[model samples]
Target: MLSWVPLLTVALLCWIFSAGQPYGLPIAVWAEDSSSLARQLVRMLDATPGLSVRAQLLSRAEAQQALQRMDVYGVVHIPPHFARDVQRGGAASVTLLHNAQLSTASSLVQRDVRQVVGTLSAGVEMQAMAKRGTPAQALQVRLEPIRTQLVALFNVSTNYEQFLAATLLPALLHILAMTAGAWSVGRELRDGTLGQWLGAPAGEAQAPARPSAAQVLAALLGKLALPLVSLWLCGMAGLVYLSQLRGWAVAGSLAWIALGLLLLIAVSLAAGALLAAGTLSLRQAMSGAGLLSAPAFAFSGVGFPLLAMSGSARTWAEAMPYTHYARLQIEQWQMGAPPAQSLPVIAVLLLATLVLLALATAALLRAWARPQDWGKR
Candidate 1:
């Protein structure tokens, strides 16, 4: 029914973008002959757009080796007799061994090769007909498209698991931090627990002079350390797992990665504190947190390259504290840079966090200064 329109719309959109996207296609080729003809075909395919040739098997045995290893999408074979058969006007066939898992690119390669062969077959037929040779025998031309050379950049291996795992780590870290910080402060406000903190008897209080800003800051920092360390450990574990298990390459130093992680936590904590101060209750803070998540994700350059975004969107992304730290993380972790290079950026984030915490404390003070309605109580 039309009642499910929004759900259906989302589902359809997800399918459209996810289905048959060529960003992660893996294609492989194996040629037997290594003849001028075979070389020509290989060159053409290598030059062909969209497909990335991962590796070329040197022999039929190598092709078998690749197939057993499950290293490629498809294996192309140019029979040793291809050139002879074409010259003798007899039909020849090229064998393509393909993995069932990489169906999309395999199918595409199959169709593309067939189209090329069809064109060549037409020419062979025309020549035979012109020579009055009864247009050849059962088959015209048999030259099969074989393995092609492919050069790739950044993600040369074409491993989807590695790609996703690497990028998702930093994004997830920042997201969870944002959620935790926002929820923690918001929960206290929404549950009216803040009143308890604000209303504790002076003598009963735990050795403090009217709960100063420094005390609150120290308390929040102390409370945050456990979660912050946990998040940092989680990020490191993800990076290590991907690198060791999946062969994900990281371009940054471990120290730099740690710095980035710390910066991201700082950014989230600052944003959460600011939100807490602005909102009257936990419900409002939670709503604000929800509103911040999507923009933070989008602005972090996970969905699209920040530079490619429109003018205003690009500006917004640049302005976002999370965006800067995310970029620093990627550069430090995936790109493999030293920690020293990120010092200035980390310092900036720390300073910004301090500024936001100061602002939140100011707001908290203003709230505390408000005259109480003891009559109702």
Candidate 2:
């Protein structure tokens, strides 16, 4: 199941979000002004990427009806005497009446509409304030006196596919890695084979034949080694596909990303193994792994900003390995941030993996020494 699920998910998501950004979202304009300025606004709105001025309604009532019928995301009402009001420095407000239900589409419409109106308003304001000058001077006055240029970085285009899907694939893989690790360890406990797997026995052997510490460690490693390699390769494969075949650019060192992903897989596996060893019950361990990893993405600040989260919620997010990996992935994949910026996060994942491995080792050692704790369905 793990082998093919990631493959299918990657394909499905890439296909679904193939268009990097939303485009041609339908909207209507309510032109109560019936003036040249109003028509110019409509043309500009239609020209903006991801927006289409589909209708020119005569009244707010007609626009609202179109909205209700799901014919458009929202409407822009050019208020009566808009041109005269602007010419007279009235600061006329072009109202954006939009359906909030479809927030994404609505936001796009709102942005484009606001930009068009703002541009037009600036030209009117600049002309009203000063006499004609050289075209360059006029352009500078219009831009400087009335409005400021806004530049969005990293995700300048606001490509949802790049923003979400790139990190999503790794987050999903982390969940699977943890679950598989729990199943590997928990199954031994469930079948009463913890001692055998740890190179101990049904009961502790007399000191001479007993498993040495190195032997015990080797035994566990031998059991999980294949799964560890397989899962890590899957992660690398997904990344390669996205960067190479899918046309997503890798902005930073692929080495940094590869290292981070490897650590995350190890950390997840160790956490799951620890959970299984601590619980000594297959079902409980698996459930615990899911409980820990499943909801972590939400807290990782992917869909929401970390700065906006409440103190306790932010604290919780910082405690998860997935959060660090997600941050590291974005730093390297999208931001192409300096290598130094990601060093601390990578260290955290490495430290977490080590700690979890130690804890799991201790738990397994305890479980192995006490055979009676095994066979707990």
Candidate 3:
């Protein structure tokens, strides 16, 4: 039987990453004067993407209390003389109080607030210019000369749920599949059932029971077949249900997702076989496999772009099968890039799968020949 430790670890990691999806980090508003201008500003902030104004606090004390209670990630404080200053053609400022501990949420709040303030300032300046009889074309040219249009592809909103969650699901499955594969083989070795598993002849026969290479391969496949199927199904569930429900732009077809899942399963099974053949006992095999696959999530270009890494780091990341799979996912699913564009990455995944499978086969064959080393610690 497999231990529950690894399963619990995977579950906890999944929950921690997925919980950031819902509110997208809601913010709070504090309109000190309760004036028309202040209310309008609050409304604009509330409507901003990736941020929602959930609380309306009357005082700084109340806003601070909300922050302390974790009711809001940030607070926008509009001063009492904000409207009066604007009417008098004097500069008016609004203060933003944010929880620095939540860096991503705080950064989003700061960016949205800055954009709102800039838009309002531009309008105010344009009105002044109009009052002075400035031409409309001149005002337009002065405000925006280049007029660069930003077309965000794939993830338009850049929602954390869609971007992070999509990549995380497959990476987690890879880890679990690899770990389970190792456990399946390692348990048989530890419990002295490997000979029976491989269908070797009974002991005390003068000639040693030599199972053919095909028989050894079949035994390994039998151990991993269920796990590979289960992981593939989970991958499909995440791609279809979670990803589609989030409104993420999937590729033109499900073929890309299916191909990536198959590659991931192949690599995972290979990793498991290698670990089982190398380790002496079930505990060692499971631990080694866990360590091997755990860091894959970080280095797979999920949170950081591969191009931004140092040359050596980039080369190292490329060596990981997950890195290629991740690249294929972003190119196909997120960027909506054609399969041709992802051919190089797909090639890498295919090559890695083949090479790892070959290595695993050789190692397992050696272990099968020397059954005395199966449970040696």
Model 1 TM-score (2 dp): 0.58
Worst 10 residues of 2 by lDDT: 200-209
Query: Model 1 residue 64 lDDT?
Result: 79
Better of 2 and 3 by lDDT: 2
For model 2, residues 182-234, the per-residue Cα lDDT tens digits are: 99999988888776676654564322355666676666667667667777777
Order of quality (TM-score): 2, 3, 1
Residue 268, model 2: Cα distance from true site in angstroms: 0.4
User: Which parts of model 3 are misplaced by more than 4 Å?
Assistant: 1-24, 30-36, 47-50, 54-69, 134-141, 159-162, 201-207, 242-249, 336-338, 369-377
Q: Candidate 1 vs candidate 2: which has greater TM-score? A: 2
The number of clashing residue pairs in each candidate reads 7, 1, 0
**For residues 1-377, what per-residue lDDT tens digits would candidate 3 score against the true structure?**
12344344444544555644444568888887777878788877877766788888887789989999989988988888888899788989999999999877788778888998778778878998899899988997887778879988567766676678778877877788788878777876787667777775556211266777777777777777777776776677667755566456576546876887777877887788778876647788788888878888788877777779899888888777788788888787777788788778767767876776666667666776676765554
Question: Which candidate ranks first by TM-score, i.e. highest?
Answer: 2
Off by over 4 Å in 1: 1-153, 202-209, 338-341, 371-377
Model 3, position 296, has a per-residue lDDT of 85
lDDT of 3: 0.75
lDDT of 2: 0.81
Q: Among all windows of ten consecutive residues in candidate 3, which has the lowest summed lDDT?
A: 1-10
